[model samples]
Target chain A: MRRIFTVWTLLSVLVCASQAQSTGSSDSETIKELMQEIKELKTRVAVLEARQGQPAPEQAAAKPAEPVQETPSAEGQTLSPERISGIFPGIRMAGFGALSYKANDARPPEAGLLGFRSGNNDFAIGDVDLFLTSHLTSKASVLSEVVFSENSEKEFELDVERLLLKYDFNDYLKLSFGRYHTATSYYNSVFHHGQWLQTAADRPLVVEFSDHGGLLPSQGVGVSITGKIPSGSLGLNYIFEYGSSDIHRPNILDPNADEIVENNGHATTIGLFARPDWLQGLEVGGSFYHDRINPDGGPFHLGQSIGSAHVVYLTPRFEFLNEGFIIQHIIEETGQKLNTPAFYSLISEKLGAKWRPYFRYQYVNAPLQSPVFSDVQLRHGPSIGVRYDYNDYIAFKTQYDRTFRRQLPDINNLLLQLAFRF
Target chain B: MRRNWKSIIVFVALLSLGAGCVISAQSKEEDVAVIVNPQNSLESISSAELRKIFAGEKLSWNSNTPIFMVVRAPQAHERDILLSRVLKMTESEYKQYWVKKVYSGDVPREPLALLSNGMQLEAVRAEKGGIALISLADVRQGVKVLKVDGKQPGTAGYPLK
Candidate 1:
């Protein structure tokens, strides 16, 4: 630990020196004052320890584990050494993985089994996210995150996830610009890749739209403004983006196929997110997204609008989450239809300090179908699972899902996951 | 057999009551500590200097290692006392510190807490510059006790009394 402290101390000094050189004025004075204060504080503490018959400075300094609390502040506040060390810019990386199994009472033509019994057994990488954040100034900063999947091999790609420059205008207001993840549904803003701290292994199906082609604009090149409401700490975040939709290929074809066309469509999205502290640790918000895709002259022209509302409550021992989504689409420039409404809810409770067990239910109906299809369809399921926080940096999870189809036998599946962050 | 079972239950109840009283009394006195790396040469730190360090206002020690402040859980009693004494801020203020720091990519390490005296000692011993407060009786051989505002732990200058 002493070594760690020494390294951190050196780094801080280097940073202060650089700052002094660059500013060449008031900052240098500040640095000198701070150093002098620290030296005096240390001397005082050593003397006090000696008076108590505790080990003297030399002896205590030799032992790495010695606890050293600084004197209280003039205001009587106790400062934490860890925070002081972190003032310098640093980087963090984190991620999670999942494995799932499924079983079906009867064989379904569309289902394939990789890890499933009577279906497919599949081992899949859920989310692997790496984060980098740097401070350009005392009041301004930048944050970036990259997500990788499927063993981080073939399907790996960078999502310019959170490339935003933030300016802290004040204690109550801030401004940001650049490509950033939209604060669309409550779930979208809270990256699931950082889900180790969450009480559940999987997000509600209604909000887990990444697997089904983000129906909502996930990230957009844009600008945003956030502020706290007057007289209260209700936070409000508003973002507007004028950019193209995220690039994605249709799920129907083999992802490896080279001939697969890309959906290069212009898009715009506006979102509003609010969280009030009235119910500490509880977050509630909503988002609206519209997309217009002028596909490359195929029958698959894209024109759709989606909106969703969600509420989430998080505490150390339990969580409650619910969300609903509505989509409207125009097909072939003539046929217009309303997609099925989707909804989901989940309740999770911590079984112990490290383990959380949860249950979830979700339902979504197929969009209105042409008379030729003979039937409208809906998919719903109930899943039970547990998540283990191995530590602040890692987690392990497993889940079992029993899905019911409108016209088919129940499909039961299991999932295992590992998530980590640095 | 019935009489013996009743007697056992009575004894257990009395023992539990005694344990509860002891726990209640202990909980009343907040144990917290100010920590620094053993390698640091400075002997005494003022309340103001400590505040600046924890608040992210002071960045270094004698222009040395970047100061790393480890906070206790917000709900912990020691944290409350620490905040009141060092930051001169309420719990809400401390929360705001983390929220702002995280958004700016300057968040400190998550605070580590030890529920028992043994655990607290282990943490202080394992991490250099680690500081926390516990019962004065629990102060062990591995950690140094620092004076606040020129007052040593047992002197008239001690902050606690």
Candidate 2:
């Protein structure tokens, strides 16, 4: 990791030098001076680490961590780091994992032995995400996150999480266009994915499962405008998107079927959101998402409207977040109705520099009245988890969930994860 | 009678601790300012103009030269203080602002940051249209401080102190 940092620093300096030459200014000299200062900083850091008796850089490099990528513009005017450790624009990686013990003898003979499990072991690489951001020009740059999932082993997926072109109409309003993740839920807006390093292993189901599958509208190509209400405590932001949806089928049930529906069909979604941040660290917002999917006589018509509202309070040491969602799916011809209303809450506390323990509760009620389902039921659960942030890029996590349901034995699971980003 | 004395002692101790905490917290808070190159002369700047410069709207020095704004890293204390005081924005708000800017191709640079206070001053001095916040005690030559609302830091009319 240290070697990578050094290499990256040298490359950045070279890039900046070239840009400075092109701009024909004192930028090159500035770059040289900045490089010298960075060197001095390294020395000072080394001395401080030694004085503190901290582990050597080589030892620290052994851990799986997020790789911080720093990009210096060709013009030598800006220096943007992927994630800041102590400041913004710094890059970091975090990991999460869990283990549990389950009781095996409490179930019927036909059922598996795992019942009321006290210690059942399960481990995973929960979230591996790399975040790269830069302020390339005074008015523009980019923010991109690459996520790697171990559970599916699908390789790396580039979530252009936020690629926006913005023109500040003024301080009160800014217009943007490009691919960006919708600012739907309070938590979803800021580092929603597991690798972003949340205190909880599992987010509230309302915010987690509102969309098809477990993924939210992580990215959509569209235009959005955000601005603060002048002289008012309210901050308003709205987004309109018209493009292909991000939903994909992992595997086809029958590849050889005569009538097969291609997963690469057309879909569109529009979202509207509002947030008020007058109160420090506290944000209250709501969003509406309408999706239209046109499939070629597929099993599902793929038309749904989801409305959600969320409130979040973030403090230096503690956070309280809650979201409620209502999803209505409509069949193309039969007029069948599918309604799902859900709510979830998460309470997180920062135990210290490296440890954060959290508790989450989720309640989801799926009505069985739709043509797509034969059974309708409600599912709710409580999960307890902890996050160990070794630094900005690497973390260790463990979580246990006990789910309560009707006409079923309590369901419990444990997970251990090592999450990292590059 | 003995119990009353113990309670009084405990009460006094708690009050003193509370007072100590308030004082310590106040002392830790540092005042900052937005600075510019001494060669460029812009009279009193409005809140809206500051927002434009900080948001990368007005991207040039007073001389009509392309303005190159300098920003501290997001995690820097001075950066946070600058956002809250000048932009009146939170960390997330500021982040979103920059992210939008990057996507637009309007601005191609992220904020520049020095690991220490001394380095921050050096960077500002070397660059033009370079604006950053530093501790009031750390202000020095090479860079001139801009009045946020027509008033200097020590003046009672100062918008931000």
Candidate 3:
């Protein structure tokens, strides 16, 4: 019995030892397999990196300073949306387009807004804007935007919104030359032409473009200087622009005319703003614009000065924007001055990842006899909207607007819009 | 009874070994290394500076080299870490931010998104101005790993993991 017990003990010990050996061997085999996989991956990576380092056939013929845009993954056999970037090389393209359906109450022709149809409910095609940008060098770049929209005659009108060549010296100084949106207001500079980017369905009446029968000179041609002010945590910045004002002339300066029409007068604008690091998403700023306007068929020129201030707080889930403008026009001959005050306050909060509700109250009052904005009588209103983002690239907005005019009856309008970016 | 005892002993041994393997194979929070081209002179970066670089606010390096940023594609563990820790933005927010930035002409182009750590390393190796982040285990030669907040990966009190 003692021998039997010893034999059993020996058998158990042998069994355990064999089991340990087999397990150790299996682990080593796994390690070997892993090492081999790593080696293969390294080789594959090297080959792919080599291929990516080589520029495409079109890119090779292009300028040497242009960097490679993006490379498609080796594992993808077909061209995906991300791979489409390789086709453009250094040039990047983005665009925004909107389609809208509007329903409004009856309104007279004289009280009609320029962009909005009065007393009619119809489906409308908003602007189809194409924005293109290319880096010519490390510090120099070019940007161009073209917009296509339907006119009252139902014909497509092509407009070049902006064409700019920019050079960056450093973080503190950047110089840009060409046609750009005037930096006299925050909305003009921050939310130019992208309906999808802005929270509201349309621009505030006070800051609308001059071409649309609005008051402000929205476009300019000349040089702009923008830079940071190096205020430790205050994050101050400045924009100084000297350009040809489009107040009296058409915003489209006749790109195909026989002779280039020189601007009658120059416009100068100076603006300063701070985005403090201590409080994220807070921006407060003020801007002043000076220009001389000679209205058509008028014998005298008017000295124009626009003073604007804005306080904006924006976050991923919430936004608050408040801006005010005091537009002063003085008749040079009689020294008579007219002041028109306008303001808008907008607030929005995101309910979840896809839905955001917003409200805006706007007021603009221009005297009936005002020379620049004779048609713009007293207009104050409230706009409430809810924007639902179908995805990151597309948004659906439903907005209701109520406008009260000085001598005209109040009008209610409802708009449903689909805005998208690509 | 002897046979039962032997079987129990063998079974216990095997069970312990299997449990050891399982525990060793369980995933842990590992350190992520910020890698750049070996030719890059930067050795350390601050949290704010990292945020700015990854956010596309800083376009050029100190040497006047146009910075080429590379990032892992969406749904990647490394990208999650970057979005939460560095940018303080969600994935959708980050995507929207870049779309706005590029469309607004603030930056000429968005960062290149790649697939795997191996590809990221290789891309960094190929481009002189390239910068990326990868797991410490995947870091190889020919790329320089920058210290975040003066602390290297795997050290005590490392900022990124």
Prediction RMSDs, each to the true structure: 17.5, 17.2, 8.6
Better of 1 and 2 by lDDT: 1
Write one digit per residue (lDDT tens) for candidate 1, span A260-293. Answer: 2325465566666565545544666677777665
- Span of 10 residues, lowest total lDDT, candidate 2 chain A: A109-118
Tell me the spans in candidate 1 whose CA falls farther than 4 Å from its real position: A1-86, A94-119, A151-160, A195-197, A209-214, A231-242, A249-266, A295-302, A368-377, B1-77, B80-161
Model 2 global lDDT (CA atoms, 0 to 1): 0.52
Can you tell me the CAPRI class of model 1?
incorrect
For each model, chain A TM-score? 0.67, 0.61, 0.77
Ordered by TM-score, highest first, the candidates read 3, 2, 1
Best by TM-score: 3
**lDDT tens readout by residue for model 2, A156-253:** 33344445555554434456677655555555555445433456645554444222123244445666665444433454544444544454322111
True-contact fraction in model 2 equals 0.03
- Each model's TM-score? 0.57, 0.59, 0.79
Clashing pairs in 3: none
Give a tens-digit lDDT track for model 3, residues B23-90: 65543367888998777899998877788789886777877666778888898767977888888888
- Residue-by-residue lDDT tens digits, candidate 3, A289-390: 998877663676788899999999987778999999999989889899999999999999989799999999999988777766655668889999999999
Candidate 2: count of backbone clashes, pairs at least 3 residues apart or interchain: 62
